[model samples]
Target: MAETLATYEVPEHHVKMYTANVQAALNKEGGILTPLVSSNAYTGEKSQVVNFIGEVEFVERSTPYGDTKVTELEHTQVWISGREYDCAVFIDRLDTLKMIYDPTNPYVERFREAAARKMDEIIMSKFFADRKVGKDGTSTSAFGSANTVVHGNTGLTVAKLRSLRKLIKKRHVKVRTVRPKIAVTAEDVDNLLGEVAVTSADYAAIKPLVDGEVSSFMGFDFIPYEDNGGTSGDGKSIPSFQDSGSVVRQLPVWVPDGMHFGQWDGLTIKISDRADKNHIKQIHGTFTAGATRLEEGKVFQVQSKNAA
Candidate 1:
């Protein structure tokens, strides 16, 4: 049978667009990933604001007069479970128009272009674009409509898909995520905010960045939900994702290079104190992969140059 472009079926480009955009948006970024740094890169920056506080409630309260204040208690504090993404934007974008669209009667093409633009707006603004966006905001390469998938298109202007393929296939820098996680004792959290503080605190810390240099380490924190005295699958209420620390904070990160992918035999990270050794205190750091709940193959691996 002669092969054809299938938007929703075999190599469906349409389905791929939505899935790719959605996963990349949620998994990594929050909005339009753009290249404020690179002119137009395969990867871009993403900004996300994690919740600083979880659910809270008013405790049993009692009012007392000035004389009775000494005899009556006022109220107490309590904390609820769960985590919050709060508000964050992930930015992602293509460097140039990969697909071709007719400009004369460019309604659909215009919409695709518009989507790209709106994505840029949302990312830059660090705001969530209501989920009312349509295909009009998306665009396809010269191959065909963004609604179409099946990367194999031979009927169009470019009979030689090989040439177009070469254009998009190149090794470039990657915009990856930095989710910092650490193991802590319940006592550690109490030490951070003090005993009277009962509410949960979710935090995000983006380190100070200098132009041209890689970013300083960042830290993120979340409340760990627990059940039946456990906290893994059932979302057991374990230690909070981000805890407060008095002395040296324990913020660990697994920096996945946005540019490299393949049979990665191993990964390594180097650390040196950025602050004045006398003022900020010199510190050393190490790296290691934590236990992941994801099953192998469930992870999405972007293809790297010459990576089979």
Candidate 2:
């Protein structure tokens, strides 16, 4: 059955909840097919912010001349030391999320291709590409969009039907939920339901705005330890100051918000173009949920390395 959402209205005390069930469904190293990170939280026109988030640690070693070259390599193991990453979630005013139920709408046949592109754009911009525009509207991709597509087959494959069975596979993006209310809201929405991507709001509280107030204050924390005592990168216990306030705090991006009550919109989509193509390639991810729905209760706890 089709679900109806209110017309672009922000609930006074309600916060928006958008959870993406991220899974590396299929990956290719040689790049026979292009990989697009999918999440409903991105715009189809540009790239999403890709962050190589981790921590830095140094070990004391000696050199031949009795001199030490203190090398530092980032460790992605912040969670092991009870530490959260410093991350932020920024929203694009350009991307859009609208449910299409009109049967005569030609786009429905392609299986939410626009939504998938939006997801890819969001991930690529953040994790891979930064931004892709200016007033003149030019692509800002590092090497450009064509660069992301490393492998391009020039000639059509000439093979027997029997021999191609192993190579040919079905393509589809089917999100199954009894109700279809998969929508996303801006970060400004306070007290949102479901999980969230948070960042520090450059606060100038002294000179406040007249209409709205910035509410959803979020952050993260970790037990960062120096070689304070133990030989094994043992970080001493530290206070929880994840991302907010500009202190030496943890920048927690996926700050779970609101109660996981009512029918939830697990994924978000920001449509920028109408994809009328037949072929599809997508990249997708989620915060801590590896082939699993994050129980609303699980957000507050420091357990579960939800990665696959």
> Could you say which candidate leads in lDDT?
1
Q: What value does the lDDT take at residue 207 in candidate 2?
A: 15
TM-score of 2: 0.18
Cα lDDT tens digits for candidate 1, 212-275: 1122221322221112244222222221122222122121111222111111111111212223
Candidate 1 stretches with Cα past 4 Å from truth are: 1-12, 30-188, 195-236, 239-308
Clashes of each: 31, 33
On TM-score, the leading prediction is 2
Question: Each prediction's Cα lDDT score?
Answer: 0.22, 0.21
For candidate 2, write residues 1-308 as lDDT tens digits. Answer: 44222223223221221111111111112111012111222222222222223234675656657766655643221100011111122222212223222332323323233333332222212222122333332434231221121111111111211122211111111112111111111211211211222322323221122123222121111111111122211111111222222212111111111011110222332222222322121212222111111111111111111111
- Residue 4 in candidate 1 has what lDDT? 21
Model 1, residue 9: distance off in Å is 12
Question: Model 2, residue 217: what's the lDDT?
Answer: 21
RMSD of each: 29.1, 26.2
